[model samples]
Target: MKIKLFFLLFVSIFSNAQVVINEIDPDTPSTDVKEFIELHSNIPNFSLNGYVVVLFNAGSTSPYSGTASYYAIDLDGYTTDANGNFLIGNSQVSPTPALDLPETTLQNGPDAIALYLANGSDFPIGTLATSTNLVHAIAYSNTSTTQPTALMNALNLTVCINENATSNAANHSIQRKADGTFEVKVPTPGMNNDGSGIVFNYLTTTFNNTSYTEGQNVIITFTTSSNVTSPVTFTISLNNGNFNASDYSGNTIITIPAGTNTASTTITLVDDSLDEGDEEFILYISGLPVEVVASNNSILRRVEDNDYQISNFGTPLAPTYGNVTPTIPTGYYASLEGLSGSALKQAIQDIIANPAVVHLHSYADIWDIIRTADQNPANHSKVWCMYIEQPMSKIDQQQGSSIVGKWNREHIFCQSRGGFQVALGDTADGISIWNTTSAANVVDGISDAHHIRVENGQENSSRNNKNYGTVNSSTVYAGPTGTQGSWKGDVARSLFYMAVRFNGLNVVNGDPSEYNGSVPSGNIGDLATLLAWNAQDPRDDFEMNRNNYIYTWQQNRNPFIDYPLLANYVFGPQYGQPWFASLANSILNTDEIKIFPNPASEYIFISGIETPTRILIYTLSGQKVLQQELSTDGKISLNLPAGIYFVNMKSEEKTETKKIIVK
Candidate 1:
């Protein structure tokens, strides 16, 4: 009690920053890199603007009451951390010192450290110490019997004893004790004087298993080191991207009572109809008592959905798209077998050049074709419009002047570029190649249903006749989700079809000037971009379905839609490779067909098949084992050895294949 005169004389009773020099470590084992001084404020996040730390040197030869200051730090514009502590130390000291000191910066002598609420200019490097406006001051030494220093009287700070007599100076630091006296103890820089940095220092959380299911309950255990005298509580927070409060039911707060060191809480999950397949969340701990925090901040958890199931369509092409059998006769491509390169392209052009195979209504009859072909798969009452790629009502045809939701026929191969039925271009769909073949060059009259698509009236005008390519002035479509990417492939395949069925109108990749054909006698280009688009984006089901519907109209199908890689064999990189029907993954679109009791010994029942075509069973090695017409009840009898086999169900419109195991 008698050695505490310095704090009583200097500490202000009504000061705003209430900061105290908490701990000081002057000497380490080697260099002074670990030396540090810790400051603590009673008010958290307190601003230490008008404060300065001045180190006074006792080496002054004069016998005066004051000592000359060796170093001073201006505490302007610095605020204490959330823990109300401002730490300063040499470079090696951590958790990152607020004021970094050079190695061996602090002198290990009968030096004094002073905290003052004054301007930094008041304490020059050699200025003597003063008691004016001093906040807290402490005098420390590395030796027990230290030389006399003016800090004893100038700041009324009595020299505190060092640990050189017992623990040695390097292993100990002088820290302020609870009774307001300094003692040589284990060095604690940023922690409390009593050596506590955490309130519940031994608290931990554990879970038996991390996986759960919807409608199931999870219990998390919270355990501490020793029994509490009263109730201890903590809060559990969630950090899943889609965590809704209503999706979970729990108290969210766990509590442990006196005489017990462990507690737990239950979290009940509410099912979301299993639409979300698998859900994951991280639990965070917070809201503990004052000065207390959880040792483990977060815990990861995953829940499986019980009702999640999917019915796949066609032969899924991995991440996107699926192959659907083209609506063509069995021997449709029999003439083009074993062909490659330009020869294969010429054969395809020959097969589709006959205009008699295609059925087209006049350009005036395009509305009926679009209404039937572009019907939305989700809402049949609406028709899908190109260009803008939006869904418009079937009745919203572009009439006299009401053009809000109206759509018009978009000639993908523009009218001036080999796409009109007359020289002057009447709206009668196009000048029919009728009996004339695609090889015959018609200068100004050509129109077919394959090149015409539905588009919004305004968007049709917005895009006028600009050739499709990587042009900076291109419209970006956002309607109907994923339309932008799919529309590119759609337009690319349509243009490829036009280049074949209408050979007079060339599609080139050269200079844009060569394609200004007001009479349809010249090129219509940027074919390089169109070919790249064909290779980049595969044909999706929307295009496949549209191709099949158009086949019903013209009796001719777009071979590119059936064989996605055909464009490559003809106009792309693989120009000379022999093409095969097997390369085309065009197989099944039976989304309704179902085969149950798949791993069967003798028989299996099938359902949802439209027209009973035939059933075939094959081994994994591609050897066919059984073939028979499908019964009306959708039943097939099979007896095979214990192995994996594929059951291929053929229907009038599509085919379905499911892998099964023989019991």
Candidate 2:
């Protein structure tokens, strides 16, 4: 069970000058922290020039066993410390005192690593040249899982060290002993491996929170199985990744007095002003008291960021004032200014893609976004729904929860059409909008606020995934008929948003179940229909609230709702013109055109025309109702209906469109 002394001597004497993989920490507590590998050299002033570290993954075949997905770090610029130690870790770790490696380099277990010297020759996996100047190589695994048999077979026999130890899920590292055998040990990276440290076989260490807001205190505790006889002191160490030691207020060590079974420490994190992703730090314990062994030695803390939650300067009240304009953050839309048409749309797309504009939330918490973000300013008791213009009770904001026949969160851009992941599915496969532990629906992508809305349950089911157009008996459903007409623009804009936001190369190749690849490349919906809806409906108070409310949670805006004219430039009649416009272009001549009783209810007289003119009348929704041809100097009288209408008169010489009010 012990390492061979001769093997140890060979390694310490011959491989010390050359870089060796020393410490490897995988299976950290939090998902965001980095997995790392530490390297050490026995020779002082050892320059790592011309050397590189490589990782070969587990469960691979021949060429793939060595060549498939490998991470390499060139050691040309790094030098060993006075103590003969150097570190090359994943990019997740901020390398101040160490060299950096890509996060993709290391897997949790069943993996192999190799160190080689560069002699201007290819050293890809499965290549015999890789063994030419091979300095050191190693393999390790968690005994409980399947062993890395394929990786072990691929490594060059010239130099390979295999460790027989189970992987630890509590962020522990497997290290080499002085006997040339590998074992789980207290990581004293950059120092000699004398194996003098605490054993936590009888105690458990736990952290209160895996994710925290900056400036919040991180609390951790150590508990013993039974009472201890004498006082015990444990040396604690902190390793910052994307954070600095100065950001916290705490000591590196804590003590547990005699007769006490538990001890705790508090580290307060300082809040920073920059908008950034989550950062992390590690807490390690050493020097245990008498007759104690560590069940867990280290814990990771992830600091969730909130610097991008800037206010939109609008009231959060529901039954919101219909006319209050939504405000975008200062300089947030600066990049989109001046660009028009397709160019402007692309710029807007780039703006929304900014990390600062995204708000990552558990699917379970989306109820708050729907209820609180879109609340009525006139009444705090109800939240407005896009479908019916009616306020929904605040109590119906939970998973599988509803107010009988009232409102629920509806995916206006059908979940299946977009294939966004919600909480109910396998999150590991891709992004999920729902919380891992919550019962929230996963069909909606997480942190995506623009595509969801409050709607009556029946209405949501009826309108599901049906394309917008003229509806009939065969159509499974028609959109909400009440105030829903007013929301056609809002609905169209939201659908356009989904098309732009999710249009990209699929993250999971060949998986049409995802949003990006679900529809054919570069297409979200019928462009012509959407453009017509945008032109006809225009923006209303309800649509404004929808934009402003969603922006508060998502940190982005619907540019079309903000500026309707952009739709023409992006998907104009010329580019995405609806089928109704089958005629070609003609000149517009307004001279000598006259009509009497412009607002007349029954009829209107047209005079002063040399040639026959074709007249076409259309509703605001772009629906053409009447078409007729008039002779020169014609007086027209006919049964006219009420409401707003636009009249287009065309001839060989000229064409003109004027608004006709039939009161």
Candidate 3:
């Protein structure tokens, strides 16, 4: 009872004078072994009868809730020493704490160490903090931001001083100087501040290569000379570039957490398809500098875009074109007017490869392209498997996804063998520029969409770098997928187009060693077999459809698909023949002549055959009724009865039997 009465008298005497919280050691070189809290009074031998010290974890990841204080002390019988300083600390402290504490009793800051005049009601363990009796308090952290402004605001503390600043670093105490402001300083428990051990402050950002490729996720890091109070957040400043914050990280924020000197986040890039050359960028940090000197806070870095599709950067897709001829863009083929052989090939190459505009697609866009170009005729929703001649849905299994079925892009002209340049591949991400034929990669011939086809993953691995020609009697190896004739013609045409498009890349008669190097060079296949396949399979509607469709997005055509006869003029029997476009519908395509508007009433137009041939009408009974000479107009009048009749087209080269219905 006497003690309680003295506590009330002591609080009444000092309630206005207010005992101040002088120092606290929340962190130490060891497991907080010497951690402690000190209080001071203006009067020596001052009794702290009703005072209490409460520790809070409002800044920790998992904060202490109401009625759950980290630690508490009741000073019912405590008194300041002669110098008016009182200490509470671990047993290892120099001048032992008047009150003892267990090791690791403190948590790193972003916390509060508050003093209170408890009004004779001592706060014991498991009690909540109260503002009613509050006297003095200190809030601290080494991070830029902390939680619950309510807690600090409740105590009128708008700022959290750094306890781990450069001067104090770690294993030190935040002590109140004579001015009553706290600064992290060397331990001075039960004594006055000497200001020793304060060092230079630094918090810097370290950078690597400035120039990263469009799709590369370059890592950026921040370093500190001292440990941070907590996790710090900052944003990248795009000082000068053709981009915005959206181009940095989807949201453009990075983090450097506490207990560490460094932290990293990748600079998410846009892997686009425009074939742009090298681009330049500058990066730096912009945010509230956490416990760092202004000089050390700056970061001006120059990076080179020497180089994928990183996280959040989606691969772009080509635009769709309705059912149109997709005829050459105006003046697109004007340069190839009278040229043939190598000259024509060179002109074609130049027309398609307009380096000025930069024609190339991203390596990441292969899936979207191949799916559309190889769209299955039977099921428009599916892609035609290149080797197996089957339909594989666009939404089915994909290589990058580890799905074991469906399709991926194939280099008809193997990228390695053709010495084509493709960005490195991430097979698991459904991306591979290796054979995409993206026009953007037109210079190297790898990103060319014309040469990239829909091939199953198994076949892609099987055909790996092998020549396009027949291996042993056929491209049909002992598997479901192979270089079958249907696809062989497609493959040959792509190779031929590539050979013409890229200089130094060739198609020879014999098998060549597979090129597996950085530079583009050497030959690709058995030209003899490719030519034969070209003759055997010719260009079908599928090839025509893709040639026309791909042109809409890539802005170029595979001449081999457009003018089948170019093959003869350049590499076949009619090698060196001066070619013309009329030949596209003439003998160049005549190996398998087609009669348009058959079952007609007026007349029938013809192509793929030379003019001035004999045309005869014969009954199914094998009796020839009439004969006429083929005309300059290349059409024949059908004036017979409305019945099925056999027409014999007789050119000087050969004769073909055709059945027509004169409706």
Candidate 4:
């Protein structure tokens, strides 16, 4: 927003004008050169009544180079030509008959003259130049006893005047009434100097004179004045149930009061039940001793008066998995040739069912088979699976496009494949596949796999796509040239992609282009989702916990299934036993941690957690309040008024979080 301040009153008779010069060559002067300058003043009807002074100053040099010179031009009796150009007088020596130059010492070389107009209060139109009508100064340096180099320049001038006559007018003030109405002096035009200098004029229209309601009354008022007593008749116009403008016919005419020279009027409201938002009202007063108008409007709204409530989703259930116990089913992949069907099935099942199954590896056939099993009624909803696939050129060509290739790979061995789809209890609702196409693909794939079920399909051939001979020349053989090398590489790559996508954990470090076979970390849940059991076992694996619990129940004949509020006790706040506290302490002690307002009343400030660190603040009730990085000085201010809160801070090197109380 830009704002400008203007002075309304002044006693000085000097005229105010601004001039600008353009187009000047310091090296040479041209005869066709043009120059312009403008002049602005408050004199109502000004004419050329004096001379203009022009000064020239030369460019500066090493020590003290330039000098100043002045020239005076008689413009008092000058007349503008057809092109609005006028030559005052022919150039001569130091002084002319009608103009004179002040005595001043010259420094070094020729200096350009700065021009000033004397007695500019009476400058006539078409006589002095303006922004549109410019004046040109042409000059040339004299190398000999002859002519000097003609310097060409343009000058532009602007004139401003303060014709405000209300500077001495009687002060007119307005006050809003307690009843949400306005009381004004009737015939409001007698408040200023004939309203001549007033830019806007206002008058009241239809006076609603209505009373105000309890919750709906907002009013605004304005005042104006006149200096005469001709009985200014003012009419007010009512619009949108509000005062618009006042006029004799269509304008508000302020008539002088009967006995006094000043007149005043009161505008009141009868109805105030207007809706909240922006409401406008115009007050136009005319026919005042002088012409003037004033306007005022307002916006209204209802204040909110309510409290906030928190909705509860109830406590979570205890994890079904138990201690690191393995549960492998028999004859799971018996159909596959040369493969230990039971062992492979058990391994795959254990990989999928283990609460610590942070990562898994398999061929397309294995994935298809597992997906089919997951679709079975007995296994449905019991297993959640996600498959990450590599982007290959052969697959791209087979699917006609990379996007289509990815879609096919995701649904590979899906439940949709006839008998395999049905036998494995495969359904459209059960499988989710993440395909690595681009870096952004990982982000999107992670979002999609976060919540999806797994279904097994029996037909591995359809899912594998062995017909590579027709797609690419490099792959003349079925699948790949190498029997096990290519398959193993592809499986490892797929597993790496899955682990990274699922847990945001990057375990492998090597160039994919180099194809270096490197084994990744085998800590399953290192990047896997955690699951707890028994509320005290201190283990985090759903499948292991479930298998162990089942085995214990079967061997000991112990009915400990519903052991002392197991549901609440197992999933409650005390379940993990200060896991977050340990993590927090480790981070703070290792990273020069500092927290301000230790016993804060409203907020806790944190600093020095190192770069690229993630900070999370949660309430005692497990409600997250802050989650972001601690860049720069590593400072984080947690807003939690007067209460105990937990702070979880994590980085690539370590993860630590702690609890602090606010006042």
Most lDDT-accurate candidate: 1
Q: Best candidate per TM-score, number?
A: 3
- Candidate 3 lDDT, tens digit per residue, 1-663? 999999999777765564898888877753456788888887777888878888766644544223235677778888976567788887556454667665667666666777887733455544555576688877776554553354576666766777667654765778888888877767887565653332323555555664455666767666667777777777766545555454445445767676766676667666655423334455545674524422232233332232211111111111122323546667666777778777877777776665553245655565667766777655454567777667665555364333246478788777766666556652324232222332334345556788888877767778777776545634323224332446766777887888777666788766676653656445777766676566556566677778877776666788887765576556654445566675555332234466668667877776656566777776543456668786443777766667555555656544454556578
Which candidate do you rate higher for lDDT, 1 or 2?
1
Candidate 3, overall lDDT? 0.63
TM-scores of all candidate predictions against the true structure: 0.37, 0.38, 0.39, 0.21
Q: TM-score for model 4?
A: 0.21
Worst ten in a row by lDDT for model 2: 505-514
TM-score of 1: 0.37
Q: Which model is ahead, 2 or 3, in terms of TM-score?
A: 3
The global C-alpha lDDT for each of the candidates, from Candidate 1 onward, is 0.66, 0.57, 0.63, 0.29
Candidate 3 regions with alpha-carbon error over 4 angstroms = 1-326, 397-403, 424-443, 471-484, 516-521, 588-663
Compared with the true structure, the alpha-carbon lDDT of candidate 2 equals: 0.57
Worst 10 residues of 4 by lDDT: 525-534
Segments of candidate 1 deviating more than 4 angstroms = 1-324, 401-404, 422-446, 473-483, 514-518, 586-663
Residue 160 displacement (Å), model 2? 15
